[model samples]
Target: MTMGTAGLETQPSATTYELGDLVAQAWSGKVHVPHFQRDFRWTTKDVLRLFDSIVKGYPIGNLLLWVRRTPERSFTLGSLRIDAPAYEEAFWVVDGQQRITSLANALHPEGHLHDPFAVYYDLAERKFISQPKTREPQHVALPILFDLKRLLAWFRTEGEAVLHLFDEADRVATALRQYKVPAYLVRQDDLDVLTDIFDRMNNYGKRLNRAEIFSALYAGPEDGAEERLNLSRIADRLASRTGFGTIDTDTILASILARRGPDPARDIRNEFTSAGRRTAPEFENEDQDTAYAEGEEALVRAISFLQNEAGVPHLSLLAYRALLVVLTRFFAHFPAPEANTLRLLRRLYWRVAVSGPAVFKGSFTQVSRVLCARIRKGDEHGSVRGLMDTMAEAPRSLPTVERFRTNEAAAKIILSAWWSLRPRSLMTGEPYDAQDLSTLLGDQKTAATAAHVIFPRGLTAQQQLYAGNRIFLPTATDPVSEIPVMLMRQPIDLDDRTWDAVLASHVMNREATGLLADGDREGFLHIRQELIAGQLSDFLDRMAEWDYEDTPSLETLDFDNLDELEGGDDHSL
Candidate 1:
């Protein structure tokens, strides 16, 4: 009997029975079975919960079975074997794989069922083991058996007179053979109905990908059309390699886009959308499909190169995000960046992955800006290599004065090169372009650099200090506030006049051109304020973006001892 929507009389009819009875009847071939269904995959918990429901007399659910009677319709049930006489030649199960598997294990003889050990019990620990066999390998549970000898022995001894209660089991089993499990039994001739029904059912718990639903709907023939060809290939590959039996491409795409942590195989269903009717939708457009395909392909390629070519050990979300951005840029601009570009990209990639995503986003934009500057500006004084060498350790610990110096060095080298080439400030975003670089680098050119003006731009410590000290000199307790304070405990033996020049240079390099309006001094201070504010805001945005729980403090990080591994290693996988 096809339990079509019209055939299903929704009069709130109720039936009560233990799962064991249903399994016995289904096994006996007295039920309708869907040809496309797989066998029971119920975990121990699922089994236990079924038993608990029976013990507590709770309503489990209706059993959905398909009624058929053709030898051609019989399919090899997964992890199950029928030993008893055939109850029905064509009957197969449509739903309740877990429930049926559980009941079989609880009542059948050990070693008689396909998977003899279906449930696990930890003898030493005296507790039921958890799901995912890895968590409880030492445990042993029940097995499905149909040996009449064993059943008789059990009834005579362990089962006792209580075994007579099976009359009730038979009654329930008989009823289930006729009861509907609330499914639409489709015919080979009506695939559209099956496709629609499958999509609706699948989208209920989590959203399915447009590609996936399309694949499932049109999966009947393997003759590949270009549009549907890749979908099946990808789906088949993912299912074979990953065993994500109940998921589709949409879930995978969402995971790639938003999931955190080091495990690429981690579930990302909840990351993209909430649980509701909106979870499953037919993919909206060609552009989105293209983006998803491109993104997945890019990620796959990155993992392949990092793991196989570069020998990187571990893949982290931080590194992946940065790499994604870099790849996106490459795909957009260079189309095919050089191997050297990949090497440089990898150098920074590992740094971010190990540092975690929160730190990566916080530092990436500034780092990218610094990188662009260096590439634009040639190494006139061997500063570019020196900067990369020094900044290598910045990813391990919080930013410190020394690390900041490295950043400053890179900035100086890059900015100098940029200015040397395009003398116009990228920061000011002004349209004015200068023709001569010499005019900017003329004698006493950096006498008003942003750094010189920005460092301790206010009045000297001695000027506001103790009753007798000079305005520029450090008092006994206030040495930290002196000009030498910026020297980081290093003594500068320069005369007052030279000290003034040094301060001026620092301010000139770091100061914004906007701050130069009322003379270099005020402009220097104003630029420092702008840079500091901008950096701080970017940092906060990273924290929010990563959803970091604890704010990480800035300190010097040691990249040397980070157990760093390259991209080509198997560990990268």
Candidate 2:
């Protein structure tokens, strides 16, 4: 039935919907998820758990929606595409987006390969697994199992091994057919009422993140577009601009807030217009549009400092985002700092990263706040000195290659330092550009996409997992497995210089290659690992500048010698 907005003062109407029908409605455009809801964040494990819950008669949750006039448009839920005609009143989903999108896309026949929704049921195991590269009769695609005609056809094609499970397949199909979702259709007229409900619902137990809360409050009118000032999009732009994946919505919000004041945890609901909010002098009395623009500008400058000057190549490689937040404030205050101050600030960055969390004498949050407080307007020199003094007081811990991991801050420091040596693509022999690296990694949350530890079956489990086996090369094939093979025969095209340069890019000398050629894989790793440890140690020490004394910044020094002081022949002093 087509429900209209009625009884605005009364409670929201409730109904139960069949799972398959809800998917069909979403696909056909009768139902739509609003933009303020979080994106599809469920991993395949989450999806599998959800399906398992359903099959085991567990309750997922209720879906809350609003009934309103929706315009004709095209939208996507995961990989499923929809084209909807204008309706006087359509169901606009306010919550349960992740579950709905998961069901819609996972059960859709057109769900793309490698999507979290690509799932199958193993009839023999009676369990769900990620879709395999090769298909077997016992493995039933979820989409096909949910359809009556397809299930009938699937039975006819399979041999007697699958015939015995007909009752189980029918039972699974019936479970899906009977599974119902409790839904609420709000008929509220005022947009504030809907936002209030969303706010109240999410605030009950802090269900939503601060970024999502800010986004929901600022999301435009019901008939307008979704999430006008989405911080996640801001993060995406910064990530793309610098090839630094995932600035993170919380960090992006904090960056914008840092441009306003030192307190990132300040009330974001009144960020722009509230007189209570603290803002930088030049940024005062601005609208959200201006705040977003200028704040993004500050963030870009900070990210560029890390990428260009600080030797950190990727966002994932940065040891701490709290450090990035502090730097964002510094750059926002002094867009082009004096040369000496910039150098000192870069040194401070290296010191903090190499020292890891131990760089903070207090709690990380307290230290971050203290650092942000140091960066005030018109005091660039003082800021640098304060930051250096604060970090230097804390002890240092240089990174080691042992227990190499993608997510650990120490490992990130090691990877960034390795890239400082300019790891090149083995195929092209060209330096691995940040842009190309970002494209290859593509918003991967960890360094696993960029680094690899090869494990040939010849090695023991302990030997296979050794950090020495790790390589930081960018190639389609693993360098450890392929490099020896490539060097086995004489190169038809390239000369020794080119090949030598290629090996150097990977931090491997011919001696290492000779070990690799002799099938002594451990020996090859040992040579490369020893070289990496020395280089990383030197890079960290040089960047930290522990021995350098802090002097007045360049602009602060008196440069008014009138060109006579340095001229040897000038008699006029």
- Every model's TM-score: 0.38, 0.84
- Give the Å shift of residue 139 in candidate 1: 14
RMSD of 2: 5.8
lDDT of 2 by residue, 361-464 (tens): 56666656778877767788877888887875755456767667789877788788878878865555667777666776767777786687654467766666
Clashing residue pairs in all predictions, respectively, total: 50, 0
TM-score of 1: 0.38
CA lDDT of every candidate: 0.36, 0.76
Runs with alpha carbons beyond 4 Å of true place in candidate 1 = 1-21, 24-41, 64-78, 81-95, 104-117, 120-149, 155-189, 205-300, 308-311, 314-337, 344-573
Write one digit per residue (lDDT tens) for candidate 1, span 181-218: 33223223244444445555555644444444434544
User: Model 2: what TM-score?
Assistant: 0.84
For candidate 2, the per-residue lDDT at 458 reads 74
